[model samples]
Every structure is written in C-alpha cells, then in structure tokens.
Target: MRLALFQMTSGIDAASNGDAIAAAMDVAADGGADALLTPEMSLLLDRDRERAAVRAEADYPEIAVLRKNARELNLWLHLGLPVKQGDKRRNRTLVIAPNGEIAARYDKIHLFDVDLATGESWRESRVYEGGDAPVLVEMDEQEVGLSICYDIRFPALYRTLAEAGAGLLTIPAAFTVPTGRAHWHVLARARAIETGCFVAAPAQVGRHEDGRETFGHSVVIDPWGRTLLDMEQGRGVGFADIDFAAVARARVQVPALANARPIPSPVRRGMAAQAN
Candidate 1:
C-alpha cells in the first residue's frame, strides 16, 4: 500500500487546520496514495481549555467535511483530534474508510503527563480521558493498529496489537521539541523492530499559535527497522510504499512473537531458598 504522512503545524484555529488537512488529502490523492496519516490535534492545538472546549464537539463540522472528501477521493484517512463525550473529552484517532464510514476509533490510551528538564511540562490527563482499549482495523486487506502520540512510549500496547495480527501501526503525534529530539526516532524504530510491523508516524512541526513548539520528523519504518521515509522538520506530505511481505520475512527471521511466553511472578530471594 502507498501511504502519505502529513506533517502539520496546526494552530488554535479549527477552520485553518481543517483547510490544511483537506488540501493535504487532495495532494495525497493526486500522488496515488492509498491512505493519508495526519498528526495529532489535526483540527486544533489550543492549550487553553476554554478555547479548545468550544470546538471539541462530537459533531464537528470539520469531521463531516473530511469524511465527505474521503469518500470523494476514494482514499483512507487516519485523523487525530480532540472529541467531546458528554462532560469529558478524549484525544482520539479516527480511521475513516474510502466509503466515508468510520472504520475504527481509538482514543489515546496513554496520556502524556511529563515535566521535562528543558522546562517543558505537559499534563494531557488534565483535559482528556484516557482510552481503555487498543484498536485494530482492516484496511485494504491489511490489519492496521491505531495509537496516538504518548502511546508510543509503551511497548505492551504495540505487542498486543501485533499479536492480534496487525501488520501496520499508525502513531500520530505532536511531540515536544526536547523529547522528540531525544527519543522520537529511537522509540518509533524500536516499536517497529519489536513488533515486526510497519510503523508510520506523522507529526506536528514548528511553533504553533498557542506558543508551543513541536518536533517535526514524520517517519515511516519497515518491519526490518529501516527508515523508508523521513520528512524532517517540515509541513508537508511524505510518501512511502508498504510491502506486507516484508512483515512476514522479518517475523520469520526473528520469531519473537511466536516465541513469546507468559512471565510468572518473581520469587523473593529468601523465599526461594526456603522453597528449595
């Protein structure tokens, strides 16, 4: 499958972000891409709770436009946005099929609550409710696993999806500059190598209207942990070809999934001697 990763610098305006995403979808379609993956908070990236809440409606107009465009273009889309559910909000990823239907919805399971030494602090949990389960959906005969930004730091989530027969993993993010510079590439490649699956990460780049800067290295990694495409620090679409056969080849070579075994509780040192 041909994939397009859109690196965006989304701002506080939902309408502007919507326009950018729509334009990128057109470019992806023209480039013959089967799917387009966009960064997290593709609609709006406002740190202000009051401003963000105003646009976080369940029936967002931007989403309707995106769905209609997806149907017209006959291309799949992986979009990340903040969604309102009753009195709560969720950082969500929606996998939209070519027929303008939602194939799968994955709320971001891992919320980013960090205080970096570089004086950058984020408390994602303050505004969003974490998702309880992982999501895997089928697209063009391929099973794709869905995850948001902070979920990349957790390996067990990726393993669960891989064990459940996911061949491609999509990680849409708006990573901070400090953390992105340190662990972005390594963690992404690690997840791909560990699961023997293709990893496509579309990220937000540059400074935003909300006064936050993001690291903008949108990357695609094969099962063999090779960087197929990297759009480093830019706001545009990057294309890559995904070969499922490579997944089979890598899994066969390593056999990590097959060889996985359940772990038992560790025995205490003194208790071990007594038991013996």
Candidate 2:
C-alpha cells in the first residue's frame, strides 16, 4: 500500500488547523496515496490547559472533514490525537476508511510527563487521560496496530500487537524536540525489529503558532528495521509503498517470536544454582 506521512505544525486555533490538515490530506490524495497519516494533536496543540481543552471539545472539524474527504477521495485516513467527547480529554487516533466510515480508534496510551534539559516541561497527563487498551486497527487487508507518541517508548505494547497478529503499526506523534531527536528513529526501528512489523510514524514539525516546538521526522520502517522513508526535521510529507510480504519474510528468517525462552525468577534461579 502506498502511504503518505504528513508533517505540519499545528497551532491552538482549531479551525485554522483543520483547514491545514484538510489541505495536507488533499495533497496526499493527489500524490496517489492509498492512505494518509497525520500527526498527534492534529486538532489543537496548545500547552495552556484551559485554552486547549476548550478548543479541543467537539468532534474536531478537521476529522469530520477528513473523514468525509477520505470517503470521497477513496483514500484511507489515519489522524492522530483529537480530543474526544468526555469530561476528561483523551488523546486519540481515528482511522477513517475509504467509504468515510469510522473503522477504528486508538487513544494515546502513554502520557508524556517530562522535564527536559532544555527547560521545557510537559505534563500530558494534566490534560489528556492515558488509554488503558492497546488498539490494533484493521485496514485494507492488514491488521494494523495503533499507538501514539509516548506509547512507542514501551516495547511490550508493540509485542502485544504483534502477538495479536498485526502486520503493520501506526504511530502518529507530536514528540518534543529533545526526545524526538534522541530516541525517535531508534525506538521506532526497534519496535519494528522486535515485532517484525512495518512501522509508520507521521509527526509534527517545528514551532506552532502556540510557541511550542516539535521534532518532525516522519519515518517508515520495514520489518527488517530499515527506514523506507524519513521526513527529517522540517515540514514535509514522506511517502512510501509498504509490502506485507516483507513482514512475513523478516519474521520467517529471524523467528524471534517463536524462539522466546521462559526462565524462572531471579531468586528461583539462584536457589536452583545453589542446590545444583
């Protein structure tokens, strides 16, 4: 499947940001993309808690348009982290099929609460509630695992998805500049390698109108842990054609999933050794 990973800077204004996302989706469609992916906080990305929550309310205009547009254009759409209808906001991803039906939804499972060396402090949990369930969405002829920015840090999550029979994983993010630079590619590739699944991450880049900066290197990695496409650090849309055959090939050769060995606890091992 040919996919387009869109990179853009999102701001606090929901309407304007919606327009931008719509435009980007159109471009992806024009580029002959079968599926178009956008970044986390695709709606309103303001750090100011009250302001952001207020703006985040409602079925975001962009998602509604993208869903309609996806059905019209016959392109599969996967957008990240729109605030859903709830007293507590949930960072979420919505997958819209070609016919404009809501196929699957994945919430951002891991909250990014960190204090950076750059003196940037983020408390994602303050605004967005962490999701309890791991989302493995079904797309055209494939089982696609779903995650958001912070969830990629946890490898066990990817393993669960793979064990659940996901051939591909979608990780849409608006990772901070510091963290994104340090661990984005490495972790993304690691997940793909560990799971033997194709990983696609479309990210937010640069500073937004709200004065928040993001690290934008939208990447697509094959099951063999090779990067098929990287958007780098800027505003851009990276496109690539992914083949599920590669996933099968990688898993067959490595077969790490089957080779997993179970061992006793550390204390049990020590006792057994002493007894021996």
Candidate 3:
C-alpha cells in the first residue's frame, strides 16, 4: 500500500486545521496514496487549557470532515490525535475506512508529563485522560497497531501488538523539541527493530499558536528497521511504499518473536530489596 504521512503545523482554530487537513487529503489522493496519516492534535494544538477546553467541545467538527473526505476520496485515513469532547477530554486517534466509517479508535495510553531543563514543563494528564487498552485494526489484509507520542517509550506495548499479528505500527506524535532531539529517531528505530513491524510516524513540526514548538522528523521504517521515508522539517506530505512481504521476511530472518520467553518479576530477581 502507498501511505502518505502529513507533517504540518496545526494551530488553535479547528476550522482552519480542518481546511488544511482536507487539502492534504486531496493532495495525497491525487498522489496515488491509498491512505493518509496525520500528526497528533490534528484538529487543534494549543497549550492554553481554558481556550483548548472551550474550543474543543463535544461536537468534533474536524472528525466529521475527515470521515466525509475518506468516503468521498475512497481512501483510508488516520486522524492522528484529536481532542474528544468530554468533561475531561481524551487524546484519541481514529482510523477511518474508505466508506467513511470508523474502523478503530485508540486513545493515547501514555500521558506526557515531564519537566525539562530547557524550562519547559508539560502535564498532559492535567487535560487529557489516558486510555487503558491498546487498539489494532485490519486494513486490506494488513494488521495495524495504534499508539500515540508518549507511548513510544513503552516497548512492551509494541511487543504485544506485534505478537497479536500487527505487521504495521502507527505512532503519531506532537513531540517536544528537547525529547525529540534526544530520543526520537533512536526510539522509533528501536521499536521497529524490536517488533519486526513497519513503523509509520506522522508528526507535528514548527511553532503552534500557543507558542509551543515541536520537533518534526516524521519517519517511516521498514520491518528490518530501514528508513523508508523521512520528512526532515519540511512542511508537506511525505510518501512511502509499503511492502507486506518485507515484514514476513524480516520476522523469518530474526524469528525473535517466536523465540520469546517469560522472565521473573523484579521481586523474584531480588530487586525488590534494593527498593526498600
């Protein structure tokens, strides 16, 4: 399948963001893309809690447009992360089928709560509630697993998805500049190598309306951990051709997933005493 990953800067206006998304989807479809993927907070990116809450009400207009575009263009789409309306919002990703129906939804499982030496502090949990379960979907005979930004730090989740027959993993993010510089590429490559799954990461780049900056190097990696496409700070669509056969080849060569074993807990390993 041909996938187009969009790396764009989204701001506070949901309507404006939706317009941009529509334009991107149109371009992707014209480029012979079977599917189009976007970054986190595709609808709106803002740090002002009060404004965000007020702007992102329960009526998600952006998702509606996405579904319509998917059906009209007969193309699959992954709306990376949108704020779902609730008393407390949920950071959610939606997989839309060509028929404009939602195939799967995965809420972000890990909240980004960190304090950086650059004097940047983020408390995602303050506004968004984390999801409790992982999500996997089958698209055109390919099993795809879903995740968000902060979840990349947790390898077990990727392992579980791969074990469940996911050959492709999607991690859409709006990563901070510091963390992205320090760990983005390495972490993404590690996830692909460890799981033997194709990694497609569409990310946000540049400055947002809230005066927040994101590191944008959206990448697509093969199952063997080879870079297929990398959007390095460019603000546009990045395309990559996906081969299902490559996934099988990599898994067969390594066979790491099949040779898995159970390990003792920290307590059994005598690490519990160290904590005390």
Candidate 4:
C-alpha cells in the first residue's frame, strides 16, 4: 500500500490550519496515496487549553469542514491529535474513512509534559488529560496500532501493540526541535525493530506562530528497521510503499517473538544484602 506522510508546519489559527490539512490531503491523493496522515495538532497549535476549549462546541465550523472534506475526497485520512475536539480537548487522532464517517478515534496516551535543560518546558497535563487505552484500526487487510508523539519513547507500549497483532504502527508527531533533533529517527527505528512492524511517522516542522518550533523529518521504516522514506526538514510530503509480504518475511527471519525471553535483570532490594 502506498502511504503518505504530511510534513506540516502548524500555525496558530485553527481555520487556516484546517485548510492546510485539506490541501495536503489533496496533494496526497494526487500522488496516489492509499492512506494519508498529518502531524499532531493537525488543526491548531496552542499551549492554552482554555482557548482550545472553544473547539469542542458542536457548532465549531472547522470540524464539520474536515469531516465534509474527508468524505468528499474519498481518502482514508488520519488527522493527528487535532485541537478541535470538544469542551475537553483530548489530544486525539481522528481516522476519517473513505465514506467520510469517523472510523475510529484514538486519544494520545502519553502527554508531552517535560522540563528540559535548554530552558524548554512543557506542561501538557495542565491542559489535556492523558488517555490510557491502545487503539487498533483496520487497514490494508491488517490491524494498525495508533500512537502519538511522546508515546514512542515507551518501548512497552509498542511491544503490547505487536503482541496484539498489529502489522503497522502510525505515530503522528509534533516533536519539539530539541527532542526531535536528538531522538526522533532513533526512536522510530527502535519501535519498528522491537515490534517487527512497519512504522509510519508523520511530523511537524518549522517554527509555529506560538513561538514554538517543531522538528520536521517525517519518516517511514520497514519491518526490519530500515528507512523506506525520509522527508527532510520543512513542509512537504513523504511517500513509501509497504510490501505486506515483507512484514512476515522480516519477522520470520528475526524470530524475535519466538526468541524473546523475560528474566529479572534489575537490582534486587533485599537480595543484595543477603549476599553479604
């Protein structure tokens, strides 16, 4: 299947951002993408949830427009954690089926709350509550796992998804410039390697009007942890065709699942003293 990852740079205005997403969908369609994905905050980028609250109102025009556009285009679109949720904005992903109906919704499990040494700080929990469930969607005759930006850092989560029989994992991210530069590619590759599944990461790039900058470089990795497509920094589309056969092929060769062994490797509390 041909998949497209939109490397977008989000703006502060929700309406304009929505329009950009629509346009990107068109580009992906023109490029013959079977499925398309956008970065996190696909509609708006703001640290203020108080303002984002307005997006949830039933009359909010942007959501309707997005739904209408998705239905019209006949594209299976994945909008990554759009800001325009509801009274309580969930860092959520909306899967728009070809019929225009919302096929599934996945709220981000791991919030991006962090304090870094470079004077960079994020308090996502203050605005958005984290989601706890894992979402698996039907796609390309296989199950696809859903995850967000910060969730990629957790290895156990991906392992669980793989155990659940997910062949593809999608991570739509608006990674900060600092973390993205340092760990984006490595983490994406690691997730694919551990899970033995194909990974598609659509990302945000460039500086946002809110004074926040994102690391671009959207990536797609095959089951064996090789990059199939890499979108260089900035606004654009990256494409890669996944060979379903390869998914099984890689797993059989690695035999990671059959070989996985779980044994206690960490320090023991009282056991260390008993040795003395």
Candidate 5:
C-alpha cells in the first residue's frame, strides 16, 4: 500500500488548519496514496486551555470535512490528534475508512508532562485526560496499531500490539524540537525493529502561533528498521510504498516475537541477600 505522511505546522485557528489538511489530502490522493496520515494536534496546536477548550466539540467541523474528503478521495485517512469535548477534553486519533465512515478512535494514552533541561516544559495532563486502552484497527486485511506522540516512549505498548497481530504501527506526533532532534528517528526505528512491524510516523514541524516549535522529520520505516522515507524538517508530504510482506520476512528472520519469554516476579532484596 502507498502511504503518505503529512508534516504540518498547525496553529490556534481550526478553520485554517482544516483547509491545510484538506489540501494535503488532495496532494496525497493525487500522488496515488492509498492512505494519508497526519501529525498530532492537526487542527489546533495551542497550549492555552481556554482557547483549545472553546473548540472542543464531539462533532468537530474538521472531522466532518475530513470524512467527506476521505469518501471523495477514496483514501484511508488518519487524523492524528484532534481535540474532543469532555470534562477534561480528549486528544484523539480517528481512522476514517475509504467509505468515509469512522473506523476507530484512539485517545492518546500518555500525556506529555515533562520538564526539559533546556528549560522547556509541558503539562499536557493538566488540559487533557489520558486514555488507558490502546487501539488497533484492521484495514486492507492488515492489522494496524494506533498510538500518539508520547505513547511511543513506552515499548510495552508496542509489544502488546505486535503480539496482538498488528503488522503496522502508526505514531502520530507533534514532538518538541528538543526531543525530536535527539530521539525521534532513533526511537521510531527502534520500535519497528523491536516489534517487527512497519512504523509510519507523521509529524508536526516548524514553529506554531503559540510560540512553540515542533520537530518535523516525518518518517516511514520498514519492518527491518530501514528508513524508507523521511521528510526532514519541513512542511510537506512524504510518501512510501509499504509492503506487508516485508513485515512477515523481518519477523521470520529475527523470530524475536516468537522467542519472547515471560519474566518472573523480582526477588526481595533481603531474601536475595540471605540466599547469597
């Protein structure tokens, strides 16, 4: 399947961002892409709770437009992370089928609450409620696992998805410039290699209206951990032709998943000392 990843520099205005997304979808469809994936917070990238809260609605207008576009273009569309109405609001990923129907929704499992050494900080949990369940959607006879930005840090989640028969993993992110520069490609490639699955990461790039900058090297990795396509630090579309057969071949070569072993409970410190 041909996959197109969009690297965007979104801002506080939902309408403008929606137009950009629509235009990207058109580009992807024109390029013969079977699926189009977007970066996190595709609609709005503001850090202000008040501004973001005002736009949070269950039936967001952007979603409706995307649904229509998906149907018209006959493409599988993944809206990276859109804000949803709730008590604390939700950071959600929506998968739209070619028929323009909602296939699945995955809320961001890990909220980014960090204090970086560079003095940059974020408190995502303060504005958004985190999801406990991971989501996997099946498309074109292949199981695709879904995750958002910070969720990529937790290897166990990807392992669980791979064990559950996911052949492709999607991690849509609006990563900070610092973290993205240091660990983006390394971690993304690691996940694909460890899980023996294709990793498609659509990312947010450049500076936004909120005075925050994002790392924009959107990349697609094959199961063997090779970077098939990378959109290095720009606002544009990156495309890669993905073959599911590569996933099967990688798993067969390593057999790591099949060789996985369960761990026993840790021994108490006192008990271990006594035994020694």
Candidate 6:
C-alpha cells in the first residue's frame, strides 16, 4: 500500500488547519497514494482551554468539508482531531474511506500528563477523557491498528493490537520537542520490532500558535526496524510504500508473537545470606 503522511504545523485556527489538511489530501490523491495519514490535532492545536473548546466545537463543519473532499477525490483520509463528547473532549482519529464513509474511529487511550525537565508541563487529562479500548480496522486488505501520540509509550496496547491480527499501526502524534528528541524514534521502532508490524507515525512539527515547539521527524518504520521514510523538520506530506510481505517475513523470522506465553505472578523468595 502507498501511504502519505502529513506532517503539519497546526495552529489555533481551525479553518486554516482544515484547509491545509484538505489541500494535502488533494496532493496525496494526485500522487496516487492509497491513504493519507495526518498528525494529531490536525484541526486545531491550542493550549488555551476556552478557545480550544470553542474552536473544536466547530469541527463538525470542517469534518463535513473534509468528507466531501474525500468522496470527490476518491481518497482515504485518516485524520486526527479533537472531538467534543458530552461534557469533555476526546483526542480522536477518524478513518474515512474512499466513499466518504467513516470506516473507523479511535479515541486516544493514553493521555500525556507530564512535568518535563524543560519546564514544560502538559495535563491532557484536564480536558480530555481517555478511551477504554484499542481499535483495529480493515483497510486496503490489511488490518490497521489505531493509536495517538502518547499511546506509543504503552507497549501492551500495541501488543494487543498485534495479537489481534493488525499488520500495520498508525501512531499520529503532536509531541513535545524534549520527549520527541529523546524517545520518539526509539519508541516507534521498538513497537514495530516488537509487534512485527509496519509503524507509520505522522507528527506535528515546528512552533505553533500556542507557543509550543514540537519535534518534527514524521517517520515510517518497517517491521525489521528499518526507517523507510523520515521527513526531518520539513512540514508537508511524505510518502512511503508498504509491503505486507515484510510483516509476514519479520513475524516468521522472529516468531516472538507466536512464541509468546503468559507470565505468572512473581513469587517472593527469601534472600540468601551474603558472604563476607
């Protein structure tokens, strides 16, 4: 499958971000991409809660426009956006098929709540509710796992998806520069290697209207931990060709998933006396 990853520098303006995403879809379609994956918060990235809520509430209109575009272009679009759910919002991904139907929706199960050494702090749980389950969907004859930015840190989720027959994983993110530089590539590659699944991480890059900087290396890693495409610091769409055969080969060569066995609870043992 041919995939296009959109590395965006989304800002406080919802309309502007929507326009950018729509334009990228056109580019991806014209380039003969089977699907376009966008970064997290592709619709609006704002630190201010009040402003963000107002802007995010208006997302349905933008989604309608995007759906129309998807239908017209006959392109599949996997978009990351903030969705208003009852009294709170959820960081969600919507996979729209070529026919403009919503094929799948996955809310982010992990929230980023950290106090960084760089004096940057984020409390994602403050405004968003966490999802309860992992989502796997069929697309282009392959099973795809859905996850968002902070979800990459949790290996259990990836393992569950992999065990559930997912051959491809999508990790769309808006990562802080500090964490991104330290763990982004390592975590992505680790998940791919562990699960024997192709990893596609479309990321948000550069300074935003909200005064935060993000690490911008949107990457795609093969099951063997090979970096297929890395759009380092550039803000646009990057393309990669995925071979499902690689997934099969990697799994067969490693056989870790097949060899996996449940571990029993640890039993405490008395410590032996140390020799003087």
lDDT of 4: 0.82
Candidate 4 residue lDDT tens string, 1-276: 889898888776778887888888888888998888998877777775555433553554776787787777777888865444433457888888877777888989887777899988788776677787999988756788999899999988888888889889999998888788899999999999888899999988888777788888899999999999889795877789998788789889887865878867886669676886
Stretches of candidate 6 exceeding 4 Å from the true structure:
54-59, 272-276
Per-residue CA lDDT of candidate 1, range 67-87, in tens? 999999999999888888667
TM-score of 1: 0.96
Residues 1-276, candidate 3: write the lDDT tens digits. 999999999998888888898999999999999999999888778788867733353476777888999999999998855565566777888899999999998989988898889888888888778999999999988999999999999999999999999999999999888889999999999999988999999999999889988999999999888999999899999899999899889989998899999976655446776667
TM-score between model 4 and native = 0.91
Clashing pairs in 1: none
The segments of candidate 1 whose C-alpha lies over 4 angstroms from its true place after superposition are 53-57, 270-276
Q: Score every model by TM-score.
A: 0.96, 0.92, 0.94, 0.91, 0.95, 0.95
Quickly count the clashes in candidate 2. 1
Model 1 lDDT at residue 48: 83
Lowest lDDT sum, 10 consecutive residues, model 4, at: 51-60
In the range 189-240, model 2's lDDT, one tens digit per residue, is 9999998999999999998877887899999999999999998986756789
Candidate 6 structure quality by residue, lDDT tens digits, 84-158: 888888999999998998999999999889887778788989989999999998997899999999999999999
lDDT of 1 at 249: 100
Whole-model alpha-carbon lDDT for candidate 1: 0.92
Query: Pairs clashing in candidate 2?
Result: 81-92
lDDT leaderboard ranking: 1, 6, 5, 3, 2, 4
